[model samples]
Every structure is written in C-alpha cells, then in structure tokens.
Target: MILWFLGLMVVGLYLSFIMMRRSLKRSALIIVFGIGVVGSLLLITLNDNAHFGMVKRTTTNEQTIYTASPNVQMPMLLKQPAGTADKHAVYIYKTDPKKKAVHTKADLAVRNEISRTADTTASLTSQTTRWEYQNGFYGALFNHEGAGQFVSQRNQLAIPKDWFILTTTQAKRLSAKLKVLQHPTAQQKAALATKVKAKAAELVKAEPELATDQTTLMKQAQKAVQQQLIQQAVQDVQQHK
Candidate 1:
C-alpha cells in the first residue's frame, strides 16, 4: 500500500515536471534532476539498509558502524546455546496487558528452565522462531500468563559446546586473571600501565569532559548487582573439564 502510494506520487510529480519543462525552454535538465533526487529518496525509503531500526551502532575511531539487530535479522533460535536444542523451546507467548514489552532479563532464565522441563513435548522442538505481530504472544493473548515455544532455523554462530558455570568468586577471579593475562610479569604490567595511562591521557585531551563524573559510584554499584546474576559461558572443552 505504501509502495503504491509512493509510486503514484512519483508519477504525478514526474508528469508535473514534464509540463513545466514544456513551458520553460531548456528546463529538461531541472526536471531530470528533480526526478533523480526523488527516485533516490524513494529507493532509500523502500529498502533501508539499516534493517528497520534493528541495527545497533558501535563506535571506533570517532566513527559509527551499524550491526544488524539479532532478533530482527537472525532467527530467534540461533541465539540459543547448542545442544540445548532439545531442551529449550523459543516462542512468543501472550504478553501481560499491564506491562508493555516487559520481558525482563530474568525471564530468560525462566524460559530456559521451561524449555528444559518440556523438552519431551512435541511443540518444544525448534530453536529458531519468527512470530510476526499477528502471531506473537501478545496477539494471541491479551493477558500475561501466555507463553509458547521458539525454534531455530539454523545454527548462527559456533559457540563452545559446553557450559562454564562460574560462582561469584570464580567470576571475580577470572576478571583478575584477564588482567594478568595481559601482563605475565611485573615489568610487563608496569609497561602496560604506562601505555594505558598515555592512551587515557590522549582520550581526555580529545574529550575533556570524560574525566568528569557522568555517572556516580552508586550507579556503578547497582550495575554490579545486575552483573552478578549473569554466568560466564563454558565452551565445548570445558564440558569434560
């Protein structure tokens, strides 16, 4: 419908330009230029490379690069951990009326558990899913207690086949380990610290306000609480370890 409307508008505009061209000598160039600009805008609107707001922006070297949105471009199933294919079912369940788009991160654990328990169920087979607005959970049910299975179309990425379950202390230890891995010896650590400090100084030179407190320590503490709930993934090798 939108395409048809845009097409009609373009046709009308072109005809008007043609009439103007006849009235004004050598105005053919103006009409052609106007058509080209309009055509380009229409093409961009019809096939947006940004994938309809699914793309996210990541920054590097003062430039932004857009990456496709996982849920919009890729099948929902591809996001699942491997081998959990049999255990997890992805679906668009009925959303609660009171809460709009309130599928909190905590719900992911519940969804995982549900899939694990209902693995034997006939409907809980696939991992990839594409529940259109008409077929999604909210569309199916007006209230909250609605849920369904999600399946994958294909494996998206090669993730480690096993799981790594990290305790709070273990995660903290790994964070320290990551720092040490960057510098095996005290001498190397000192050198890296100096290099990092220099880089930080350069960044502050470019963006002087970065040195100021944009977020308070309390906000950092709150974020730490949320981070504690997440577990580091284990790879295929770690499964047998």
Candidate 2:
C-alpha cells in the first residue's frame, strides 16, 4: 500500500511539471512574435524618413532655385507698343544710361512693353527698378543729367534743324505710320499705293540729300538694301525657326 501511494504521488507531480513546461513554451513564442513585429515597423519608418530627407535636399540645392546675380550698371533699353489712340507705333529707348549695352532683361522688357504698354510704369516683381520706354530712342539722352547741352551740340549735323532735332513724339509717329500697312483697315488698303508714294516723299524730306559724296550715298544705299534683305531672311527664320 505504501509503495502504491508513493507511485501515485510521483505520477501526479510529473504530469503537473509537464503541463507547466508546455504553458511556458506557448507564452515565449507569443512574446518573440510581438517583438519581431515591432522591430519591422520601426525599420520601415526609418527608411521612409531617410528617403524623404534625400529628396528634399536634392530639390533645395538645384540650380533652378538659385538667384542669378543682378546687373545695375548695364546699358538697357525698353520698347513698348503704343495704344490705338496713339496709332499703335512701337516705342524704343534706353532705360539705363549708365549701362552702354542691353541685357537679357532689357530684351525681354522690350517685348513685354510692346504687348502690355506698361514698361515704364510697371513695377517688375523680379527686380525693383523704374524702367522708361518712351516714344523714341532713349539712349544717352534719358540719363544725360548734366550733359544735355553737350549732347545737343554734338548732334548738330548739316541736316535741317527740324530733322536734326527730331523728338521722341515724331519717332513714335513715324513707326506707327510704317506699321499701318501690316494689317490695314479698309481705308489703309484702299490708299496703300498713294500712301507708299507719300511715304517716299516724306522720307526724302525728313532725311534730305545730305552733303555727302555721291559714291558714299551709293555705298550707303547698297549697304542698307543688303541689311534689309538679311533682316528679312532672319525674320522669316525666326517666324518659322
């Protein structure tokens, strides 16, 4: 009896120990799986952040976003197109007298001023400067400050005083008259031939036969014709280029 009792006790203790061991194995497996899932999520988040940082850095450093250096002491001209009331002539002139040459900005301004008619008064958002695009060539006259007298004296050629002292207003008027033939109205088309004849007479009067050698006049005419032909060809290419 004592031996049977001892054997039963030993069997019960062994069964309990086996059950405890199985429960511990199940708990350990669940904990290890949870740890693995958490680690994977953390790694994915870190990778995403790193990729975003790289994209931002590359975009911020691109050359397109960088500002180009501004040029203030450059000779620049502004050209605008007059309104219908003013006969729609093209206005060309200098904006800066200090600079002797036009720049990329000036070229763009000339085009914009024509289409919009606000070159002189418009405030460019890109750069803060007052650019004037009056009726005629602005050049050194706009920025003469104190050299007007000298410039006026130097411009005195043998031409008639009226022709020599041509104003911006006159230049604009001439440009408008020339532009009239492009897309003429009924009146313009009807009188085209007569207008051309009148234009030739006016040109002759405005730029009368200056006291120059006959040979020089012939050379000048030839050069002007050649330049016109070349310009026409270039314009054709630009229109179709």
Give TM per candidate.
0.21, 0.22
Q: How does each model score on lDDT?
A: 0.35, 0.33
RMSD of each: 23.8, 26.1
Across 74-188, the per-residue lDDT of candidate 2 in tens digits comes to 1112223355453333323323434342222322222222112222321121222232223233222223122211110011011111111112443344335435535669885
Q: Judge candidate 2 at residue 7 and give its lDDT.
A: 46
- Per model, state how many residue pairs clash: 17, 4
Q: Model 1, range 51-81, lDDT digits (tens) per residue?
A: 2212222221211111111222211111223
Error of 2 at 234 (Å): 2.9
- Name the lDDT of candidate 2: 0.33
